[model samples]
Target chain A: AQSVAQPEDQVNVAEGNPLTVKCTYSVSGNPYLFWYVQYPNRGLQFLLKYITGDNLVKGSYGFEAEFNKSQTSFHLKKPSALVSDSALYFCAVTPGTYKYIFGTGTRLKVLA
Target chain B: DAGVTQSPTHLIKTRGQHVTLRCSPISGHKSVSWYQQVLGQGPQFIFQYYEKEERGRGNFPDRFSARQFPNYSSELNVNALLLGDSALYLCASSASRQAFSYEQYFGPGTRLTVT
Candidate 1:
């Protein structure tokens, strides 16, 4: 029932350019949205999350996300793209429970 | 200062065999959770244990079971593994008592390949 969707399977951006990885969530009650990055053969690393506060939330590695309640979106954004930033990104939502539902994932490639 | 840790970075098993994956949570974390991440897909929740108590479970089958110890370390046991059971098993830890909604820290994960 509660889930997050990443419509884009892959996103490409040139190095030093801004990048955006879109995520929209469907859930009842308030949505706890989170973004995660996974490198090849490694576990997922937390990027950021939006709970109940300000719509614009900043996170590690110069990453930030905007939580739009009206559009049911929580898009991950970066002012500049680096080649190292290229990885699998996932959007997740939890209904104030220990269980989390994740999206299929989006692969971002930063071209030089 | 260490992050979460999982044992046996890689494993190869046969269908119908059983496997046990282990995880050690970060220091002071009271909650441990398990997830299954198939290639090209997001991690799916498998189980969550808090203070050695089962807090939540995912849509996995009964063949999947897990438990946490007093030290906050945990293990996930899967029986009668099928080809579909092959996945990257991830373990995450959090301090549920500290916040309204806690962000989880993940381990490197154990890659299981079943033939």
Candidate 2:
């Protein structure tokens, strides 16, 4: 079965500092990876995805993720973090199927 | 353009009762999927419909059911709801089911609380 793992339960970073949310996956064949952010009482908003080419994929809200094939990882990163960027982050993987396997999620707290 | 829309932003029900949740996919979107998001957990896939047909279903029980209309709108029905059913229900839509890398647009979600 395909699965996604987000090792960190929460990550704390200072404002204006670089941040990384780690994600790893186990899936057969090629993997379609995605990152989504969720605010309190709000549905998830798409951040970025790795479909085909381009190991580094840029997305909305100044977020980007790098797809590392050898490491089997797709880590979300931002050059500088903002207090408003604090939220729940989820990593999902799809095997070109209708269902998406999601990780437990990691809470990112950007300290100001 | 409007994003995916779900009706009744919040709902409260008791165990053994039935609840119906509605969702309308984005304009021209042909696929709709439902997910259950428990507090502090990532969303779990419930069902997926395309062209008014069931495309996929998750590991949920038979009490959980859903359908897609000709206009691509959808409704999720849970019979004999249990307290465990309390969670946020999310609806997502995509251009088509055939697109392997299709991105899904999500609605604000309906918060369901079962007592």
Candidate 3:
């Protein structure tokens, strides 16, 4: 069985400041992790994925995530936050299976 | 190319009524999946189809069913609708079922309201 946990229900950040959204997962085999963002009334947009490369994976819109095997964590990070970045972020893990287990999602609010 | 597309942006139905939602995968994509997201919750997997065959199904009741067309388009049919069945039906597509690690593109979900 695979599961994801995002402990925080919401995250508040200031524009132009660094931001971080926490995520962790539990799976049997090696996990394939991904990050997605969903705006109001829109579909989820892919941010980044960790397959089998570096621990730090870079993605679109100046987003990145660090995959830690020992910690079973894949936390999303950004150097500078923009008001446009405000949205609901989800972390997902697929253990080489057809189904994807997603986190509860974290609402990011960037104050300008 | 346009991303995954779903029809009927919104719908309303009464109890015991049946509803059908449609989805068109991205061009050249052979895999399509459906998910249901209730208010204040993350999306839950419903069904996955590849090559016009059922690949995986979630813990849904028999009232929920789906099929894929030869063109890789898919439809999700729900019978005996209940108030609990009201949710956002999302469609996602990937290149292949084997590529489970690949990111899936999602369509603007159809919001279903059961009255």
**Candidate 3 residue lDDT tens string, A1-112:** 5789999999999999999999999999999999999999988889999999799999999999999999999999999999999999999888888988888899999999
Q: List candidate 2 stretches off by more than 4 Å.
A: none
- Taking the candidates in order, what DockQ does each have? 0.69, 0.72, 0.76
> What TM-score against the true fold does each predicted structure earn?
0.97, 0.97, 0.98
- The alpha-carbon deviation from the true structure for residue B9 of candidate 3, after best TM-score superposition, in angstroms, is 0.4
- Model 1 lDDT tens row, B85-104: 98999999998842227888
Tell me the spans in candidate 1 whose CA falls farther than 4 Å from its real position: B97-100
Please provide, for model 1 over A29-81, each residue's C-alpha lDDT reduced to its tens digit, 9 standing for 90 to 100: 98888999999888889899888889999999999999999999999999999
Ranking according to DockQ, highest score first: 3, 2, 1
Which has the higher lDDT value, candidate number 1 or candidate number 2?
2
User: How does candidate 3 score on lDDT?
Assistant: 0.94
- Candidate 2 clashing pairs, residues 3+ apart or interchain: none
Residue runs of model 3 more than 4 Å from their true location after superposition: none
- Weakest 10 consecutive residues, lDDT, candidate 3 chain A? A93-102
